[model samples]
Target: MKRFIITEDGSHSLFSAQFNQQYHSLQGALNESEHIYINLGLRPALENGPVSVFEMGFGTGLNAFLAWKLADQLQKQVFYTSVEAYPVSMLEASQLNYEEATGEKGFMQLHHAPWGKETGISPFFYLRKEITTLQDFTPDRFFDVIFYDAFDPQAQPELWTEEIFTKIAAQTKPGGVLVTYSSKGIVKRALAAAGFAVERHKGPGRKAHILKAIKL
Candidate 1:
C-alpha cells in the first residue's frame, strides 16, 4: 500500500489503502469535517439530547476529533464509534495535527487515551475504535448520526454498493442522517434502496455537491 500521496489540491497525507487516498490535507480537511458534517448534520440533533456518531472510515481520526470537540461545545453527551481495518502507527498519527488545522486540540487526547473494544475518552464522548474491516463491522447498536466518510467510491467500490448500504441503513435510527462527500447516481440509489430519503447538498472545496440521506 502507498503510505502517502498528495492530492491535486496539494494536500499531503497518508493513505488507508482501503480508500486509496490521503484522508485530508494539513490545511483544511479538519475544517471541512467540522464545518460540513459536525456543524450541519450533527449540531442540530445534539441540541435535543445525547448524540451518537458513527464513522465508516476512521482514517487519521480527523472526523472523530472534530466530533469530540463539537460535543464539548454543544454540551451534548456524545458516543462516537469508528471502524478502521488499518489503524495508523503513533508516528504516522503524530504527523497529522488536527488541533492546529481546526483550532480543536481536545481531539489529540483521543489517540493517547487508549485503544480497546470500548472506552471513554472524556465526559462528553464515549469512543470505540474497532480495528476491523468495514464489511465486518456488524452494528450491534444503532446511531443517531452516521458519518459516512469512507474512501471515494472509485477507489473503494464495494463500500458504495447497495448491500453495504443495506447494512449501514440497519444501523441508523429512523430520522437519522447519513452524510458524505459523494453524490454519484449509484451511491444515491443504494442509499435509497436502503430506505433513505436522499438529498444533494453543497460540498466543501472544489467538489460541487455532497450527499445527505435521511433514514425513514
Candidate 2:
C-alpha cells in the first residue's frame, strides 16, 4: 500500500511499499523536484527554445505540474512525455497537496488528463503520459531534456544499467541534458558508457550531490 507522508518542506510525498521508497526526497518533495529537475534540467533546456521533455517516472505528477507552470510563465512551448508502468490512482492523486502548497491550480487536471494521448494542459504545455515501462518504451521523437527520476539502484537496478541509459541516450538530441537525484558511481559509469558527459552538482537537502548528464 502507498501512503502519504509530509516532507520537511511540508509537501506531501507518497511512500511506496512496493518499491520500499518514497517518490521524492524525505527532506522536501517539492524542493527536490524544483532544484534537481526544474532548475538543473528543464530551465536550461528551455533557453534553446521550445523544449521537449521526457521523464522516466511520473509518480506524483509534481515535476510535470511544475514544468507546465514554468512553460506558461516563460511563454515557451513544452512538449512533455512521461512513462510510468504503475500509475497513481485519482484518489491518491487528489490527496496530494501540491495545488495548495504552490498556489497553482491544475494539479487534478494533470492527473485527470487521458493517458497515451497528447493533452494540452495550457497553450504553452502539451503532455503525453504513456503507460509502459522504460524497457518497453520506444521514443517517437528525440527530446531536449530527460528527467531520469526512477527508483534508486537498490530498488530498481535494472533501470540503472548501461543498456537502459543507452536506450534513453539514443533518443536525446546532441547536447541535450538528463538530470537525476542520484550520483551513484554505477549511474555515472552507465551514463558515461552511454555517451553522456556527466557532471555532479550540489543536491537539495540531505543528499550531497546529484548528477546532470549531457548527451554527446
Candidate 3:
C-alpha cells in the first residue's frame, strides 16, 4: 500500500492513506470539528474547568490539533484518547503538508507530539493512544466528550454496531456528548439502544444531519 497519498477534492487538498485522511485546506476539517463540537458544545461546559476529549479515530491527528488550540483558548487542560490500528510512520507522516495548505506552522506541530508507551502525549494533553485495532480495544475513563470520527459505517460495519456504541457509552460521564458525522437510522438506533439520548443535528457542508447524543 502507498504510505501517503495527496488526494484532492475539487480545490481542496486531502492527505490520505490506509489509516487517515485530512482536508489540508486551512482548518477545513479542524474548523468543522472545533466549530461544531468544542466551540459550540464542549466550550460552554469547559468554562468551569478543563475537558477530556476522547476520539474514536485520531486519523491525521487534525482533531487532536484543533482540540489543543481550543484548550489554549478555553484555558482548560485536555485529555485526548484516540485509537489507531495503522499509524503512519514519521517519514510518511511528514508527507502531510497541512502547513503548506493552511499557511499555519502550528498545524505541523500537532502530529509531531510524543506518543505514550500507553498513556499520554504531553503534560498538557493526556493521550491514551492505543495503536491497535478499535475492535480489540476498550475505554478506561468517563470522558467529557467523544468524537466518533471513524471511517464510514458501510466500509467498517462492525464499528457502528449496538455493542460498540454500548461500549462507548460506558466510558462517558452522565450527560456527556458524543458527536459524529453520521446520522443514519441504524446508527442512531444503535446508539439509542445502547442508552444514549440521540439527536440528529445539521452537519457541516451537508445539510442532511449528524448525531449528537447526550449520555443519561
Candidate 4:
C-alpha cells in the first residue's frame, strides 16, 4: 500500500509499504528534485541544444514536471523518457502538493499522460513514459542526461548492480550526465566500471552528498 506524506519543503511524497521507503527524502522532495536532477542534471545538458533525458524512475513525476517547466522557460526542446515498474495511481498522484508548492500547474496532466508513447506536455517538452523495469527496458536511442532515481540499494538492491549501470551506460551519449541522490562506494565503483567519471557533490537538506557521473 502507498500513502502520502508531507516532506519538510511542504511537498508531498509517497511511502510505499512494499518498498518500505519513501519515494523522496523526508527532508524535502521538491528541493531534492530541483537541486539534483534539474539544476545539476538537466540545466547543464540543455546548454548543448535539444536534450534527450532518460530517468530510471518516475516515482512522483516531480522531476519530470520540473524539467518540463525549465524547458519551457528556456525555450529549449527536451525529450524525456522515464521507466517505472510500479506507477503511482492517479488518485495517489492527486494528493501530491507539488503544484501548490511550486506554483505550477500540469502535475495531473503529467500523470494522466498515456504510457508507452511520447506525449507533448508543452511546446518545449515531450515525455514518453515506459511501464517496465530497468532490467527489461531496451533503449532505442542514447540520452544526454540520466536521472538514476531508483530506490536505495537497501530497498532495491538489484537495480543498483554493475550490470544495471552498464546497461544504462550503453544508452548514454558521450559526455552525458547521470545524477542520483547516492554517494555510496558501490555506486561510485559501478559507475566507474560502466565507463563514467563519477564525482560527489554536496547534497541538499540533511544528506551529505549526491553522485553525478559523466559518461566517458
Candidate 5:
C-alpha cells in the first residue's frame, strides 16, 4: 500500500510499502524535484533546443509537473516520456499537495493524462506516460534528456546496474545528458561504462552530490 506523508518542507511524498522507501527526499519533495530535475536536468537541456525527455520513474508526476511549468515559462516545447512499472493511483496522486505548493493547476492534468499515448497539457508541454519498466522500454525516438529517478540502489539494485544503464544509454542522443539524484561510485562507473562522460554536481537539501552525465 502507498500513503502520502508531509516532508520537512511541507510537501507530500509517497511512502511505498513495497519498496520501503519514500519516493522523494524527506526534506521536501517539491524542492528536490525543482533543484535536481528542473534546474540541473531540464534547464540545461533546453539550451540544446526543443527537447525530448525520458524519465525512469514517474512516481508522483512531480518532475513532469515542474518540467511543464518551466517549459511553459520559457515558451519551449517539451516532449516528456516517463516509464513506471507501478503507477500511482488517482487517489494517491490527488492526495498530493503539489498544485497548492507550485501554484499551478497543470499538475492535475499531467496526472490525468492517459497512459501509453501522448497528451498535450499545454501549448508547450506534451507528455506520454508509459506503463512499463526501463528494462522493457524501447524508444522510437532518442531523447535529449534522461531523468534517472528510480529508487535508490538499496531499495532496487537491479535498476542501477551497468547493463540497464547501457541499454538506456543507447536511447540517449549523442551529446544528450542523463541526470539522477545519485552520485554512487558504481552509478557513475556504470554510466561511464555505458558511454556517458559523467560529472558530479551539488545536490539539493540533505543530498551531498548528484550526477549529470553527457552521452558521448
Candidate 6:
C-alpha cells in the first residue's frame, strides 16, 4: 500500500512500499513538477505550437495537472499520454494538496479518465492514460516532448537503459526533447547512445543538475 507524507513544502507525495521510494521530491513535490516538467518540458514544447506529450510515469497525476493548467493558461492545445504500470488509488489521490496549490480544477477528472481511450478533460487538454510500462508500451504517434519522470536509477535501473531510450527515440520526432531530473553520468550516456544531443540544465532547489536530451 502507498502512504502519503507531507513534504518540506507542505505538499504531499506517496511513499511506495514496493519500491521503497517516494513518488516525488521530499523538498517540494509541486515545485519539482513545475520546475522540471513544466518549465523545461511543456513550455518549450508549446513554442512549437500544439504539442503531443508522452510521460513515463503518471505517479500522482501532478504532472498531468500542471500540463493541463498550463495549456489552459497559455491557450494552447495539448494531447498528453502517460504510461504507468501501477496507479495510485483514490484514497491516496485524495490526500494530495496539488490542486489547492495550483488552483486548477479537473484534477479529479484527469485521474478519473478511463484508461486506454483518449478523453477530453478540458478544451485545451486531451489525456490518454495507459495502464502499461515503458517496456510494453507502443506509441500511437511521435511526441513533441517526453517527460521521463520514472523512479531513480538506483531503484529502477532497467527503465533508464539505452535499450529503453532507443525505443523512446523511435517515437520521438526530430528535435523533440526529453526532460528528466536525473544528471547521472550513465543516464546521459544512455541518452546519447539512444541518439539524443543531451544538455545539462540547472536543477530546482538542492539538486545540482537536470538533463534535457534532444533528438537531433
> Which predicted model would earn the best lDDT?
2
The C-alpha stretches of model 4 lying farther than 4 A from their native spots are none
lDDT of 6 by residue, 67-87 (tens): 999999998999999999999
Residue-level lDDT tens digits of model 4 in 1-90: 598898999888999999999999999999999989999999988988999999999988999999999999999999999999999988
| TM-score against native, each model | 0.89, 0.99, 0.81, 0.98, 0.97, 0.98
**How well is each residue in 43-109 modelled by candidate 1, as lDDT tens digits?**
8779779978888877778778777777787777889888887777777777665556555666556
Q: Assess each prediction's global lDDT (C-alpha) against the native.
A: 0.77, 0.95, 0.68, 0.93, 0.91, 0.92
**Model 3 per-residue lDDT tens digits across residues 1-216:** 333434332223344454353433232454466556666456765776777777887667667766766676556788788887766556654666655654545654555655544444445555667777778876767788888877777767899999998898888889888888778888999999998999977665543687888898
All candidates: CA RMSD (Å): 2.5, 0.6, 3.7, 0.7, 0.9, 0.8
Q: Give per-residue lDDT, candidate 3, residue 58.
A: 65
lDDT at residue 136 of model 4 (Cα atoms): 93
Order of candidate numbers by lDDT, starting with the best: 2, 4, 6, 5, 1, 3
lDDT of 2 by residue, 41-131 (tens): 9998888899999999999999999999999999999999999999999999999999988999989888999999999999999999999
> Which residue pairs of candidate 1 clash?
none
Which pairs in model 4 have colliding backbones?
Answer: none
Candidate 1: where is the Cα deviation over 4 Å? 1-12, 16-19, 25-27
Where is the poorest 10-residue window by lDDT in model 5? 103-112
Ranking by TM-score: 2, 4, 6, 5, 1, 3
Q: Tally clashes: model 5.
A: 0
Off by over 4 Å in 5: none
Error of 5 at 22 (Å): 0.6
Candidate 6 local lDDT, residue 137: 90
